[model samples]
Target: MNDNSSRPLRLGTRRSKLAMAQSGQVAQAVQQLTGRPVELVEITTYGDVSRESLAQIGGTGVFVSALRDALLAGEIDFAVHSLKDLPTKQPEDLALAAIPPREDPRDVLVARDGLTFETLPEGSRIGTGSPRRMAQLNAWARELGKEIETVPIRGNIDTRIGFVTKGELDAVVLAAAGLSRIGRSAEVSQFLEPDAVLPAPGQGALAIECAMTNAPLAATLAELDDPYTRVAVTAERSLLAALEAGCSAPVGALADLSPSPDEQIVTEMRLRGVVGTTDGKTLVQLSITGPVPSSSEEAVAMGHELAAAMLDKGAAGLMGERAL
Candidate 1:
């Protein structure tokens, strides 16, 4: 324990409802563990202020850099972020002290009428800002021999859903976990299966970051880290790193860990990754299964290997294209 009870734990978070909800959860956990009060410090990020498309905003770091700045400057003792928003490359001075257990890492389609993808009308307007979701949805539409339009939309979950409710869009794609965490799961019309729509790397997970020198704070955060979740997200993040892709790139990956009944204590993990064109015209996906890695480094290596296999099959060119 740091024995700094006089100073409350300062938690930095974005102002979005989802971000607040997630950060609040982490704050509650820390308070429970340390029996100390925690204060949440809201930080507005570029992603929150920019009306320009994500690609124009310099991709992955938009949502995270501000928080990192706060952490480095001691404006806050630590910060929490959606792991998916974090860049694959971490800053050297900051440490990812904890990755709490992951949530459902699947994309969900929210429609006004509870309509599934197949049941949607022809030429339906689907809203999403994620190139990865757009790519998958378009690809699936193509396979089904249906014409669909993907509209560029951005906002927090509620605002995005408003498009559908207001009849501007027939449906929208969002991460299932985000909706679930904010008690908006009822808005989800269909949970897109992983095979149909792989999630962005590190989706549905939270990252707790603190200064590298804050060993005491880091040690406390370690108590919140779930080993299985850490291993799985580590592998997925590693794959993203190997592809040299930013968070906004059309990249999706997921790793699942399951306890082996035969081995009693051993667990097996299956990792899946994809790189695709923003327009859904091309894609390369790969999957691998192995025993859960004992260390974060090993898990990351597995992800890299899977990404390399996909790249060898022409994933690079697809991932390199400009967002549509």
Candidate 2:
């Protein structure tokens, strides 16, 4: 330990309920790991206050910049972010210190009357803001010989669920991890399989970031890193970066661990990806499993290779120029 245990660490977080709840868990983990007191510093983000839709404002970066600024300005020692909201490119002065163990990385349907996807009435309206979700839902509807309408909506989970409770929509899709974090997992009526609807890259994970210059704090935060989660997210995000896609692009990826015979912490990354148009037409999906990555660099290479395979199949043209 760098012996910073005597001083309380400041953890920056968005003021939203989900953000606070997630930050609280990280704070407790820090306390238990280092015997240090942690203070929560609420930081408002552009995404929190802006009325512009996430897609119109260019995806989740609006939720991330303010926190990074706080860390760089020394307003807080570190900031916790929903990994899916972070940009693939990182600021040179910031170091991603840790990726804790992930929660369920599947998207779940929160519906009225506890209805599953199959049982939802034809032309039922479902609310979601993610292009990936919209595309996948449309594709799934086509697969089942059904028609459902996707409404563009954005808000905190409670507000989203209200649309269903108030009969504004028949259902909503949300990350199972978010509901689980806020103690509302029981609201989920069904878990969307990755084959039918993959999750966003890095969804259901947290990214702990600190100033690169703060070696002691960064080292301390690294203590909480889960190697399995780190490798999985690395491969997923590597595809996003390699494909030159933004956070809101109609792209979904997930990487999970497979059993290994050696007991040396070796794990294989079985990664799946999807790319499609928002209307559900021109959908392309693929899967590839890579051998145990000896280093983060190797893990990222596997992602690039997998992306190359997808691109070779015209996935890039299907994505069009909207990857911006």
Give the RMSD in angstroms, all C-alphas superposed, for model 2: 2.1
State candidate 1's TM-score: 0.96
For residues 220-302, what per-residue lDDT tens digits would candidate 2 score against the true structure? 89999988888888899989887777888889999978876775655676888888898897787888987767678887997
Stretches of candidate 1 off by over 4 Å are 1-3, 262-266, 321-324
Q: Rate the local accuracy (lDDT) of all candidates.
A: 0.89, 0.89
Backbone clashes in model 2: 0
In the order shown, the candidates' Cα RMSDs to the true structure are 2.1, 2.1
User: Local error of candidate 2 at 176, Å?
Assistant: 0.4
Encode model 1's per-residue lDDT on 1-324: one tens digit a residue: 245687799999999999999999999999998787899999999999999978667577899999999988889989999999888888899989999988998999998789999999999999999888888899999989998999988898989999999999999999999998999998889999999999988899999999998998899989999888888888998898888888888889989777777766757899999888877889897899998899988998899889889989998888753322
